[model samples]
Target chain A: MSRLNIAPTKSNQLNLKRSLKMTSEGFALLEQKREILVMELMRLLDRVKVVQQELAQRRHKAYATLRKAASHNGYYHMRNIANGINYEHDVHSDTRVVAGIRIPTLSVKQGAFRSQYGFADTDSLVDQTMIDFLALLESAGKLAELETAVWLLARELKKTQRRVNALEHIFIPNYKDTLRYIGEVLEGKDLDSFFTMKMVKKRLAEAAEAAEAAEQAQLSDGDAPDTTP
Target chain B: MGFHIIGDADTVLGYRFAGLSGDVVETAEEARVAFKAAIANHRKGVLLITEAVEDMLADDVTAHRLSSKPPYLAVMQDIWGPRGKRRSLQELIYEAVGIRIVQDN
Candidate 1:
């Protein structure tokens, strides 16, 4: 692996070690986050599948019933009845946080159902169309919620995966290489200084021993001369 | 926060009867404008677009779908029913997650 362009020093080694530790921890956390996001995404995907199927069925039934109603009451008559409808329900939009994502949710506050149309004008076909469409709307709302959650979770998962890859493949390895390089350089410096110190100490001891030997010989020569005289 | 719709006349009117507000767009440009305005409103939590209008502004819809932002959009069939085969759950999951999920049943 290519090492980072850093000076191989003891202080740099310390810093690299700290950073490597932190990066490994961050990678683990991101990995966990990715797993959670995937799980959440899968759950939402399953729900979306169920909701989509239900929505398709409801859409077909609702539109078919609407076509029949339009044919029976006439298109203009159906439009008029729809315009005259005063029975409106409240849809409350709120958010639920899943894995730190704010997933929007829609709920219809069901109120008392009142027949706003006059019995003399509209037929039961109009009534059936209204019921079918209402059901369709409910399913559509649910599908929207699940699909949004899935999209958001998937996006977060992709981002987390990128970060994890960078740390696992690049950042952490670079730090480790730098640390090892610095460690080897420091050890080599220590070995060089130790050898030089040992040589200097040995040379000083040898020189001192030679000087003592010369002084002793000189004293012995002076004593021999005094005795001969 | 509230839910909104952008679609044709009958789809908009049908949802309006259910007490939801909507914008009825006749063309691609109109659909694009309505979608832009709808997403601009942070209070809009859900946007239900008819499949026909979605076809008109497919790029914009796909962009918003990938953005993972607020005002989630769901395309539904108009009163006449879906024009063509809508994307299956597997296809949608692949688009969102980039993984092909094999359906067991």
Candidate 2:
């Protein structure tokens, strides 16, 4: 493992341990953030699915009605209808943040689609078709909001995943290795000094014992009688 | 703000009856400029871009989808619209152009 290039000193050891602790804590915080974001994303995914299904049905109806209108009268008449009548829908939107990402909330507010084509000349089917399209427009607003929300959440989810991966796979592992290397070196020095102290103490004890024995032998042998006389 | 219609003259005209104000552009380049102006305009609440121009300026439209602010882009689809159930090129062209070019003998 590639350890950080630095002196293997006690201060270095302390520094490494401190940094390792901080990194691990940071990693934990990020992991939590990722988990929360993922949960939020899954919830939003469910919403998107439901709205999408509804939107599909509405869209089918809209297109079907449009085709009916075209066939019932004439393509020109259908074109004139759009050219004759106008429907202005006001959309009120706001933003709310989820996991630090801002998403839009939309509501379509419209009263009715007015007809400029005279009621005297048009068939009721044409009016019904117009109504269907207006309803589709309202649903389309919800579809847009939901779809946009999913996009924003999905993008944020990708970013959170990247951060989590960096901490788990790269930074955390590197710090752990550096801390382990420093710990091993410090332990090796401690063992070495321990053995050296043991050896010095043993040698000093043996020298004292030998001196005591020599004094005892001289006294016992009465070598040169007592110097008191 | 006002919605934008960036497509053929007819599609833009269809929206005009609704009293909705928008731009009718011929080229994708012009549409892009018009789209930018619409997004920047504070009064623009919703944009009703037709499917034709939306297809041409796909990237710009997608980028606009990510915008957190106002002027929500809504791609309006008429009777003849893009993107639906699959059809062979021959069938697609026949349906779009209504010309019986490909005849099975």
Model 2: which residue pairs collide?
A86-B18, B1-B43, B1-B44, B1-B45
Off by over 4 Å in 2: A71-81, A192-229, B2-26, B42-44, B48-54, B74-105
Each candidate's fnat: 0.37, 0.22
CAPRI-style class, candidate 2: incorrect
After best superposition, candidate 2 residue A149: deviation in angstroms? 0.9
Q: What are the candidates' individual DockQ scores? A: 0.44, 0.16
* TM-score for each of the candidates: 0.83, 0.72
Q: Enumerate clash totals for all models, in the order shown.
A: 0, 4
TM-score of chain B of 1: 0.84
DockQ winner: 1
